[model samples]
Target: MDIIRTISKGTDLGGKDPDHIVELCNEVVQEGHSVLIFCSSRKGCESTARHISKFLKKFSVNPQNDDNEFSSIISALDALRRSPAGLDPILEETLPSGVAYHHAGLTVEEREVVETCYRKGLVRVLTATSTLAAGVNLPARRVIFRQPRIGRDFIDGTRYKQMAGRAGRTGIDSKGESILICRPEEIKRIVGLLNESCPPLNSCLSEDKNGMTHAILEVVAGGIVQTANDIHRYVRCTLLNSTKPFQDVVKSAQDSLRWLCHRKFLEWNEDTKLYSTSPLGRAAFGSSLSPDESLVILLQFFITLIIFEATAFNLVEILLLL
Candidate 1:
């Protein structure tokens, strides 16, 4: 039995009361539940974590040390427990119980530590950037969105939907709760965005002109295609989906494939409707083999040109030349 509570028409508390957020945080902790507080910036994460730590001190936790070298979430928590110093200008205090900050810039190992702490119930609250909504599965009993409105037009609906989605966890809590603190006028849009169903954005191939050109050149360099029909068959069978009829997409794929064929990276057969990679193409693909590698050797061969150009010219110049 999950309940979705919408707090409509409320005062904007963006910078108003640190105590209100801290109090709600303490309430969640007292019930032995974890909470997630989403903030806009890295500095905001540090600031919110600090403010909550002050109110948390009564629960017997010390503040974090400014000089302490904290590389991971576990280390940060440990440092907070060991140090007895006051809060930093940005960070208020350590979680009187347990809490941590999560963001992208931190190393993968550090993010793992934060995730581990939340799952183990060692960290009662996590103040993090919106990135947590996508890749990680760390769920909280309560999710507090500190940002009610994003400025960008394209982000309005999609961004709010993602932040609101974090409210519910399937296994841990029977139900989940999300709180959005905002001015009264903004509530309807927030609620509407949360309730509406929007299709996921379609994935598009990179439009980097130079990268596309290089990809074509690599195919040519490998000596693959001998005829225009071979090039057309390759594009039709491998690159462009037969089901979808987007002329632009088909044209792009055809052009790029033709360039590869002309460069000799692949040899094309009209009758068999097959394009085979050449000797140079095979060696290039296997030159730096790894089980986890993403692109095939031919694609990598094409990418090298873009990389080389990037090194030689500034991005603006490269774009202009491309």
Candidate 2:
């Protein structure tokens, strides 16, 4: 997706001025096209939507036709009122002007109403958090980023592409455009992001993320791995091994195995140099529990069992002493 770059004299936090954003939406809506504005936070989404809605209402832009027998905007408003969240005050103000914001902070019912309205063209301008880009199919003629960052950190290439992809729906719009509102100091960074390639794929089983512990436990418990040699062989074939140094991969695997043994999740025979899953490990593997999860569950179970035994046997005094 191609981005039409724009610079802004922004706030201290580096986001574009909300008034400028409202005017941009005004221009897009006047041309009879929908616009999607991506904001960094849920609060930002609501604030930006309020700004655009007020502007649209003041100028009577994109107003719903009068005397419609069944107006979707009215229907959406009714739906929100009946919902558990009871017509979000922001939505109550904005939906009448064909504007709304979407984010996780809204109840499921609220988000559904906003999404349906936008899709049916009842809502002309939508402001939303970055999650809307990744999770929803709502597209627009023009996509605008209120800020380059989703939160405090700058958005990466993949996320930018995801949000930008929402522009220019396949059959509806003949052309799609993406605009990034950045401060002067951020121009170089934004340009680099526009040119950056997607980051390389990494294994979910990488030790750095603690996935190695789960992987090693599963293999050994399932009898797929028998010894340290078998672990080294297994490690050599994984995606983690491909990206990391051979020695590092083996060391990580060995460390995970040792950890499992130390936690009594696995047993190792010094003479045979073989590894086997303990009863706890077998139970954990069978239940599809992670090593840490299994430990917590076991501890909780034993605590409950001890309490029950003490109470049933009338040994509360002895229990306390021990």
Q: Model 2: per-residue lDDT, tens digit, 269-296?
A: 9998889999989999999999999999
Q: Evaluate model 1: give its lDDT.
A: 0.60
RMSD of each: 12.1, 9.5
TM-score for each of the candidates:
0.51, 0.61
* Model 2 vs. true fold: TM: 0.61
lDDT of 1 by residue, 285-322 (tens): 45633211323554776799889887777867878988
Q: What count of clashes does model 2 give?
A: 0
Please report the candidate that would top TM-score against the real structure.
2
